[model samples]
Target: MGQPIFYGSVHVLFYRNDEVLLLKRKNTGFMDGMWSVVAGRIDGAEEVVSAAIREAREEAGVDIDPSGIDVVGVMHRKNTSSEWIDFYLKVKSWKGDIVNKEPHKCEELRWFPLGDLPETVIPYVKSALARNHDRIWFESFGW
Candidate 1:
């Protein structure tokens, strides 16, 4: 036996009023054209919450305080090649104007009503958000 290998990612949801920020994925072969929140793979030796803050800034050009982030849910998923552990975080506050910092990787950034997200949202992302946070501490997909 060997050590288990799982790729970890962090996602942050930025909300204003009744809307949540989402980005249209592009050029990323995994889920091109799908809507997703600000997210990225965790870098080496970085904490999950820190990764969430970093991703929010990197993807949306916003600065988020650590104290304003809340861990909402986690999803453990598997594709044909590998496993993933995705941490979902909700941001209570942030600074700076939100913009698409990575135009090449993202097509556009927009805000959508939390209750009526776009039909093209990534399946797991939609599933995670639709469920009550307290009811879904962890989720598994493509087992």
Candidate 2:
């Protein structure tokens, strides 16, 4: 009889023309071999937008200004053992070149055409991208 806790995370989508950046997960115990966007959990007391900016810089070697990004969608996903609230943000512009800053956790960094994403993309991530501009603010998965 306690309040349910849903962990919060941020996902950053970097766009160039009609393509979007994606990083292949590697060596990470969870979701290894899958492609995903730059993402990480929000630290305590951190604002969601701040977390998205931080994650983009940490994972993609890019600096995103607060005004250059927008929260496009929110996903409530339930996996086998945990629930997650993931905020998907789109980066209109950023500073610095994109790179795989976390080599141990990410295998490759590449851009794919929005209309031709790879089949290996993470399920929830693909869903978010497919609906990024549909004005759908909320989505849920796995019940």
Candidate 3:
């Protein structure tokens, strides 16, 4: 038997009033032209929550409180070539204006009503958002 291999990623959902921030993916080979939230893979020697805070700052130019981040959902997603353990965190408080810190990997940063998101959002992200609201703890995709 071979060792099980799965990648871990953190998705930070920043909400302001009734809106949620989304980054338009660009240049990134994985999900080019799709809309996603502030997210990235967990680095070595880093806790999942710490990864969330780092991604929020690196990708969106904001500082999130570690205590303010709540794991709203976790999704086990698998495709033909890869699998991911996605940590969906909701953060209501943060410092600094949200800007596109990684413009090379993203097109624009925009806020949308949480009730209605763009049709071009990555499918799994859309599902994750709904799951978070429904209080569902875990979900599987492309199994």
Candidate 1 wrongly placed segments (more than 4 Å): 1-3, 134-136
Q: Write the per-residue lDDT of candidate 1 for residues 48-119, one digit (tens) a residue.
A: 999998898889998988998889888998888888999989888888999999999999999999989999
| Model 2 TM-score (2 dp) | 0.95
Q: Write the per-residue lDDT of candidate 2 for residues 6-111, one digit (tens) a residue.
A: 9999999888999999999988898999999999999999999999999998998989889999888999999888889999988888999998899999999999
Residue runs of model 3 more than 4 Å from their true location after superposition? 1-3, 133-136
Q: On residues 10-62, what C-alpha lDDT tens digit does candidate 3 reach at each position?
A: 99988888888899999878889999999999998999889999999899888
**If scored against the real structure, what TM-score would every candidate get?**
0.92, 0.95, 0.93
Q: What is the lDDT of residue 54 in candidate 2?
A: 92
Judging by TM-score, tell me the better candidate of 1 and 2.
2
How high is the lDDT of residue 126 in model 3?
A: 88
Worst 10 residues of 3 by lDDT: 127-136
Which candidate should be chosen as best, given lDDT against the real structure? Answer: 2
**Cα RMSD of predicted structure 3:** 1.6
Winner by lDDT between candidate 3 and candidate 2: 2
> Best candidate per TM-score, number?
2
